[model samples]
Target: MAEGGQIDTDILSDEAFDVLCSMCKNQGKNTEGEQYCVDCKDYFCVSCVKVHSKVPLCAGHKVLDKSQIKSRTSKGLPRAPTERCDRHSHKHIDMYCQKHDTVGCSTCMAVDHRLCKDTFYIPEFIQNNTYQVVATREIQTKLKALDTILAEKADRFKQDKQRLLKRKAEILADIRKFRQEINDHLDKLEKSSINEIEDKVKSLEDKIKDSLKQLQANKSRITSINDKLTSTNTNQSEVFVYVKMAEDAATVAYKYIDDSELQCTTEDIEYQPDITIPTQLEEKKTLGTLAKKHTKTSVSLFQI
Candidate 1:
């Protein structure tokens, strides 16, 4: 309820006041509130109040009609149930087992308290005993404490969620950094290998080119000697001298050709990569393992 655009907390205790029937509103109906159930913490229409009165659990609950609601002061603001069963999350607290001195939902009576001979409906039990102001105050105090504990837990859980998200982002970044580092190292190794191959091939090419030049020089000298011997104007002594020079040249060329044989052979260069690198990588299941440590806060479970 609001007055002058401000909530009237005194009239409704710590809760926001609603004039509509909560039960009807849940069923998608808009009905005016006729009565308020202090135990259920809900407003109800005339029809719903009748149902509430008939229920063994809610029959004896403290209620206020519309006239009483308007006249009641802040001194005795009603205390009501939060209305959920602790064990059966979907069920509501609606029964009391006097034999075990326990209260729970109807399911609890059916399963665990069926054998108890002293069981009584929650409202019937309340009706049998005189209502005490101390009991209502005690219940209100517990509700306030529970609300505080739940609020703290909610805040902590939200903080933990944010922390987990941040941790995940950091881990992902580290993985990408590791991958980039490996790629850089491999790139350097590849460049060095290429340089080494080029250097060796260039050295071998220079040696082969030098050997070919010497062989060509020897062939030219032999051809010049043959031309001198075939000429009709050349004397016999000159021909003999030229033939002798050719024989000396042939012996030197033969020795050079034998020494250069391996250098002049056709060759193909190839690179053999280290297979162990890839093999080890394939054998690995992960870059690293992810782990977590958790600490649970002790909290007393709320019961109806």
Candidate 2:
């Protein structure tokens, strides 16, 4: 209904004044409407009212006839479902059952809740329920606290997520760095081992060269003796040959280097990388729950 729009007449209070017809061309404020469409929750002119009964969805809507409505200036607004029973729409809830903690009409009392207690008045209950009053008042503060606590917890949850991610990245970086260190250590060990083997080979080569040189000198000495004997017509002293024999049994027992001592072997080296994170930390998906608690305010207002 548009503002400043009055009822149709003094006697007959038409419901058409509360809301303006949406289908009408009158966007002006004063629409002295005639009929009320409950489904659309709007007021309509006589002409537009007929369209509501003919339309598909609007046809099923319960409309309050013009005769049932009155103006605010008359008897004020009528008592709505507050006095009426939710279960029995036509009857008012006049009785209360203490045992079942519910309200009902006369028919409901007789048929279902037969053995109920005294008729507990709702107004008295609302006034005297001190626990409900105190709790509701306290819940106002608690409701505000929920928002503040949840905000703080949410910030902490984000911080924890950030920290967890940073720590995870750090652990992974450490693993990579450790791997690089192992590679460098292995490179050093390999270089040292190869240098050792090269030194041993050089020493063996020098010894073999010395042995070959001595053998060559011995051959030269034997050749010189043979020449001298031939020149003397096989008349050279026998002592000379004896002296050659005594020359250190060098030729006969040429002290050979033991090759068996240079057997192949491997160095002692190994790698171990182990880490552990708490199973609880790994399994948990969220930190905790953040929810508004049920309290007297919610239960009273929403009938929870």
Candidate 3:
């Protein structure tokens, strides 16, 4: 036995460093033998290397040292034999036995797979297909998952849009209600002020009418007394009494006349409402800071 089990000297010679040729065994010179692959440990001559390279399945194997092969075999690792099987040790399973689902040497093939017609070489089977079929189902599953994720993201975006729209409508309705309240308050204040101004104007007109009537009566009496004094046969005492009465009426009318009332003063008043709507709200536009100040005055009449 070599290291682990019995050695097959027909495949490897213990004296020579080169592996045996699979075509011509011990009869050929050792220099005529082929180089062996380090990874797969398969022997191939110059011509065999060329033919193996042309074949699709065996093109990727690397060739290395024969001494390295011995070290690997001593360590209980499989070595590429000249005519033995790649899987089984000490048993050269050459021909594939389909009935038993295994490869066999001449003895095994004759014994186990004699009538089995489904057997084939490994190289021929691998060359018939260009790509591996094991990864197809896994790739399809990942693609389906990615599609589902994208669809869910699209639905979420649509739902978010609808929610935003509802929120926007609610905000707009609130703004409108606030604006209406501001307008109603302002209108009430303006109406109250107008009514107060009209009442003051009516009282001032009545006082003005009473003063004008008194002034007209004083003027008429003074004119009549002067005409009597200018007559040819005039009474001095009667004329004097008429003049005294006219003078008293004139003083009374002057006191009753409201001189300060007719002189109205316009005061520039500024009012900032407690509940003020923005200028933008009044204009019914988007809010911005653009305003210009113009002076506005209110006139009020008062008696001295």
Candidate 4:
């Protein structure tokens, strides 16, 4: 079995022979190129290619490049058990099973999916039911707009509250200053009235002191005359004591005047600013449900 007068065993040993055979099996030397088909286990040149299939035993299989075959096979291989039909493990659930109200693969449609109708591809189903999706999206947009408006309104409320408080403090300060001026005016009026009454009382006291001194002098003169008459003991000698008494009564009256009762009047002052607070709109529960439903639909579409 030597091609060049050397025994074939010299080039290939028992271990090396198996390795070479495996390499030939994988590469398919007769067909050419590095890639090979899984079903045919044969390599083919670019010009000699035919078709491939996503699901085996179906009409037209996807044509694949020789170089990309390995990557494709790796990607398409199944791992754990999926919702896809067991009969056709390679085919994913791609259509709605109307009988079960669920999605299923092609095999389920043909077999276990009983009495199923209105089956459609995932894309086709989404395309047909677009109105629901559009309505849901509109609700989500409105919710977002409401949230933004609420944020702005809250900021404005804070600013307005701060401004109003500042104005109120200023008004209170003005009121306090006005009150102080009124008190000062009352104090000055009362002080002037008290000083005038004190001056009048001092003048009356001086006049009463002079009248007492005059009465004391008259009493001394009368006593001296009586002593002379008693010492002389002569009836013919005339010793005369002259006394003049006039009853006179005069009343001094003091009247007090209150400054507040006189000419003082207060004017009512009122400060009012036009203020309007926005009423909070009631949150519609239906919109929230619509938003959530649309979010789920979007996630499902992304997965597809």
Best by lDDT, which number? 1
Model 1 worst lDDT window (10 residues): 295-304
Instruction: Report lDDT per candidate.
Output: 0.49, 0.39, 0.38, 0.31
For model 4, the superposed segments whose C-alpha errors exceed 4 Å read 1-131, 184-304
lDDT by residue (tens digit), candidate 2, 178-229: 4354323333433433354334334444543454454445444444433433
Give the number of colliding residue pairs in candidate 2.
3
Per-model root-mean-square deviation over C-alphas: 45.5, 48.8, 51.9, 54.9
Judged by TM-score, which candidate is best? 1
Candidates by lDDT, descending order: 1, 2, 3, 4
Candidate 1 local lDDT, residue 267: 32
What is the Å distance of residue 299 in model 2 from its true position?
A: 40
Query: Per-residue error at 1 for model 1, in Å?
Result: 41
Q: Tens digits of per-residue lDDT for model 1 on 136-210?
A: 334334333433443443344344444433443444444444545454434444444445544644554454455
Over the full model, what C-alpha lDDT does candidate 3 score relative to the true structure? 0.38
Question: Least accurate stretch of 10 residues (summed lDDT) in model 2?
Answer: 295-304
Which residue pairs show backbone clashes in model 3? 41-80, 94-104
Kindly report which residue stretches of model 1 are placed more than 4 angstroms away from their true locations once superposed.
Answer: 1-96, 103-127, 184-285, 291-304
**TM-score (all chains, Cα) for each model:** 0.32, 0.30, 0.22, 0.20
Model 2: how far is 72 from its true place, Å? 4.1
- Poorest lDDT segment (10 consecutive residues) of candidate 4: 245-254
